[model samples]
Target chain A: MCGIVGLFLKKPELRPQLGAHLQTMLVGMTDRGPDSAGIAVYHRPVEANQCKLTTFHANPDYPWRKLGGQLAEALNAEVDVEIKANHAVITVGAAEGSARAWITRSHPEVRIMGYGQLMEVYKDMGLPADVARRYSLEGMEGSHAIGHTRMATESAVTTEHSHPFTAAPDMCLVHNGSLSNHNNLRKWLRRRGLEFETDNDSEVAARYFAYRLGEGATLAEALEAGLRDLDGFYTFTMGTRDGFAVLRDGIACKPAVLAETDDWVAMASEFRSLANLPGVEKANIWEPEPAVVYTWSLQEAA
Target chain B: MNTIDLSKTPVRELNQRLHDLTPDTNERLWRITNLKGEHALAVGLTVPIEVEIDGHVGYYCAGMNKEAKVVITGHCGVGVAENIMSGEVRVKGNASQAAAASGHGGLVVIEGDASARCGISMKGVDIVVGGSVGHMSAFMGQSGSLVVCGDAGQSLGDSIYEARLYVQGSVESLGSDCIEKEMTPHHLAKLERLLSRAGIEADPRRFRRYGSARRLYSFHVDQAEQY
Candidate 1:
């Protein structure tokens, strides 16, 4: 089992403070998932066709600096890249209509799980406190964010398997339980030409959502479709540039708690993670009903 | 007596400190003050230490307790004293579901009511509830003694195996394969000891015992739809 948390700040100025709050929340749930942690923050887009990418893998001998230079030269774009023990974050600025297309064409083997105009995904293999300091997460500035602390039961322990997996532009997802039908779904998706980088069930779910989104359904509609088709125990939350949503399987074998105030909306795998939130005593905490789809739109709320 | 106040200490730190103390060390008295739904209080202890939690706990309080006499002064949440190998856990207030589920050994005493499935899947652990127990209290219970001093809810014992159930009040119903057998003198004597151990001044002669009839384990076509 893993722990996932997502917060959609009503105020844009609180973006920088989000990393600190996310670190605190993730810290409280360390026991649920002590293997790895990751965070993805989404800020307002600066250019029409620029995308920030972060990739975390288990390889320690990756030639990051050389790869960054090569990628920059090949794309003919200004690229800023940072590589850590098992991960790398790359930001690229391309021509207005060709940035995403160019990145996709250049790195066809890399699974582009999440893509957005201003999204930055950082991940590492350790506790949240260590990952926060290692990634300098305290300085992150974004309108909203989502994170995952993974325990790695069914999947191998690697940064690539850690979540808030991005499936399409401006869309990301984090999950908290196992999917029983993962093998079947993986074969089905592969038959449809979807390539998977990791064997984690979370990747299958992320791609399923993306497949639906590609078919012109909204994120909320895709999630509702998932509740009907996806089998097994799960309580997942996904976020996009404009909105956030929560989903629970037919039987809630896992736990999830949601608490929202006038200022902030938070969801965690356990209530202990929400213990230190402001107005926790006053806020009403609720467990999402089984097979229910709950969504919140930051843009609509604003 | 060294008194440790848990008001300012974290639960992990407090449990660690308690575990470090020796068994023969002078009776350490701890007062868990200002507790509001904390979890895993006094868990996994081997020493004979006494801990009194001041208020309600969230879950798994005193879990896997062995050779430690821990007492909860207030209501306990799910899985309290679960999988206890030895020692005793006395609850002054109500207990949540699965109070002593899968306990291999030891004694669990609840002063107040116990919610649903109190001893579901119990194995060799003796549980005595002073108040009533809810439905499916001992579903799939394998071994040990479960004594209920008050009324038993629906399906008092379901699909049980060798676990002795003693209830003093009316039983709502018996589950599949469970039947009320004749209370022998040996059963009466065991019930007496369990009642005394739980510190209840009740008459053992007033309680009725229930156990597995062993008819469901082996199935026949005639009994196919009986369950």
Candidate 2:
């Protein structure tokens, strides 16, 4: 059992309250999944030539400043790092590929949680409320956010095993159900030169979308492809730089409730996560149908 | 008349209070407010009382009800009236999956659409949906009457038994051993009574009736491929 929640702000004025609203939503799902929790927040974009990397180290007191200095010298570019708990948001004036290569080679212990211009991913093995508090999720601001509380049905309960797995830049996925064909799919993806970070089934789903998108498939098209290829009872809430999407399998045993008001669009595994949102009483709430892809983006909202 | 605010009172306490009520209890009319999609609200009741929930609810809102009439003013989650023996559970808005699963008796009404498995394994309950129902509704239903005013999704009544299904709109597909039967006069009368009981006004003659073909009841060698 797992819980997924996503919020996309249609109105720009509600951007500052995104994390607070999402925090409440994630905490409400604690009963559904208490093993671990993860969140991905998409704030405003960085400079055109810069990319931000959310890096995690097991030791909370890891020398992030020394790593920043070395990264600056190695890349021959200005590097900025901000520490939060055991994670650091590293910004550099280079492409994601070069930065990732340098960090993996020089700082082997540091794990890159996510890399994009606007997104920062944080996850840990703990209760949802505790994880939220550890990262101060309520005070953060973003245009969109995706959260997952996992019960760890098919994998170990570790920070790496937690969800909101990012494969391609500016994209992440949180899944609520297990996949039966992940081992075969993972092998198929590995043959395509896709490097996997964990053996978790949900990670395979995330990378599958990334693989499809890499091959020039649109978000909806990639999801439709998933409907045909991915074999599972999954309710996935995925995030991109511009928006987020919700998809349920054909059987759709995993529940998903979508609510959209004039200000925001929210999707969760159950209505309890959405019950406390502002203007929820007037929101248009319904369950996403089976094998259907529902996407909400600021581009379309404009 | 009694009013219980669920925000201040826990669901377990409220259900216990309702369970303690006798058949002739003076507090027959009850109102619940601040219903923030909580689960198992007003469940396991045996007294003849009326419960009115003022907001959306989570799973199993009024399950195992015997003689109560529970009404939700907003949407409901999965299994709204699961395993109900008697009484009525009504949802004023849309309902999630398995709306009245394994219900043995009484009536369940959804004024809006019902998601997949609307009346799965229903024993004897009557479910009336003012709108459509999702896939595999009434799958393996033993005995009951399911009335849908709108469309029905795929595989309606896969392995149905004595239960009867009536749909006013189109059916995407029918399950194995479940075929469209002629809408007889007796079925029209029963549909009329069910619609009127749920306060929905629909022409009974426009609905189509479906039931089990009874082919799978005895299992013959020639029908092995269908299985």
Candidate 3:
């Protein structure tokens, strides 16, 4: 079991405030999952934004820093580059919107996990408040964001297993519950040459959604594809560069709640998490029907 | 008695207030009304506080209770008094299935009827239902006593261990490997003690006992065909 939350603000100026409210919502749902926590925020770029691509390797013998430096040198010929750990946050002059695609073509196995003005993904095994403070989550800002608090049952408890797992640029997902047909889906995806880092079923789901989106399908269309094809219990919220979308499994073995207003849309695993939101009204709160796809768009923001 | 009203207070705060109270410190009484099927009501209590809920609860009401006494003024949903380690839970109205299910130790007295699979997979808790129980009552019963003052439903005591079943009325049907047993003086004594604890004045002599025949414990090729 795990908890996922997301918020899409209609007004770009309210992005910082929405981030603060999402932090409170995540803290309220800390009990559902106490393992690890991560967040992804989508911010509109000004002119050119830096993108960080971090990859976790199983082999400790590999020279991670040297590899990052070499990638930076190659990317710097086209733009300015800075390296940190196993990551290289590149700020390109020409590749404004194409940073994600360029990185994908250059490094096939390595994913452009995050892309935006500010995208930080950190994992820690503890209470949500403790983990958030440790990761400095309060300083995060964006127009829309998605987060996950993991309770590791099916997979190993590690940073590699922590979510908001990004399969491509500007596409990240946080999921709850297990996929019953994960093994079958894994074999099919592997046959299509899709690489998987962890054995988690959530990764497979992310890949499935990414595959659909890559085929020129809209976010809603890709989510509908998941509802038709994916089996078993799951409730997920995917964060994109513009907005976020939420989906629930057919039987709804897990729980999820959605609350929306004129200015903001918020979601969590329980209503208690959204109880104290700044502008939340009691009547606007409702639970998502089982197997139904519900989406909130920041594009409608004033 | 000290009375606390739960009309406007949040359930979490109410539970916290209940948890902080002590038995000898004060005789605490609470009137929880307008409860719209909330989960974990009055859960994980150790003090000797008495709580009276005015309406139905969703799940795990009085769960993991110890020392405190709880009385539901109205009907209860699933897993009421579930996994009760000690103390007593008296339901004034009909209880849903799995009442006192998986309870390790304690006493549950249902003044009204209990639904299907009552005390299913009971560990050691004693349950006394004044009205008839539904089908599969005490299915996979491990140990403890389930005394149904009314009729027992079908498949009663299926796959049962050492737990005993005493019913005053007729049994709809027996589960596999279960058969009626003689209610001797020893059984009468046990029933009397349990009935007295539940504050029921019914005579133990009129009731009959049912238990596992122990024929299904070992495998036999001849019995395999019968199954």
List the candidates ranked by lDDT, beginning with the highest: 2, 1, 3
Model 2, B1-227: lDDT tens digits are: 79999889999999999999988899999999998889999999998899999988999989998999999989899999999899999999999999999999999999999999999999999999999999999999999999999999999999898899999999999998999999988888889999999999899989999999988844567766876
> Of the candidates shown, which would achieve the greatest TM-score relative to the real structure?
2
For model 1 the TM-score comes to: 0.63
Docking quality class, candidate 2: medium
Give the range of the ten consecutive residues with the poorest summed lDDT in model 2 chain B: B217-226
Stretches > 4 Å off in candidate 3: A44-69, A76-90, A93-112, A116-120, B1-227
By TM-score, the candidates rank as: 2, 1, 3
Q: Extract clashing residue pairs from model 3.
A: none
lDDT of 3 at B81: 90
Candidate fnat values, all: 0.00, 0.50, 0.00
Q: Find the 10 residues in a row with the least total lDDT in model 3 chain B.
A: B217-226
Pairs in steric clash, model 1: A113-A166, A113-A167, A114-A166, A115-A170
Per-candidate TM equals: 0.63, 0.97, 0.57
* Candidate 2 local lDDT, A1-302, one digit each (tens): 99999999999889888889999999999998899999999996889999999999989999999999999999898899999999999999999899999999988888999998999999998999999999999988889999999887766888999989999999999999989999999999999999988888989999999999999999999999999999988999999999899999999999999888889999998899999999998788778889989988778998
On lDDT, the stronger of 1 and 2 is 2
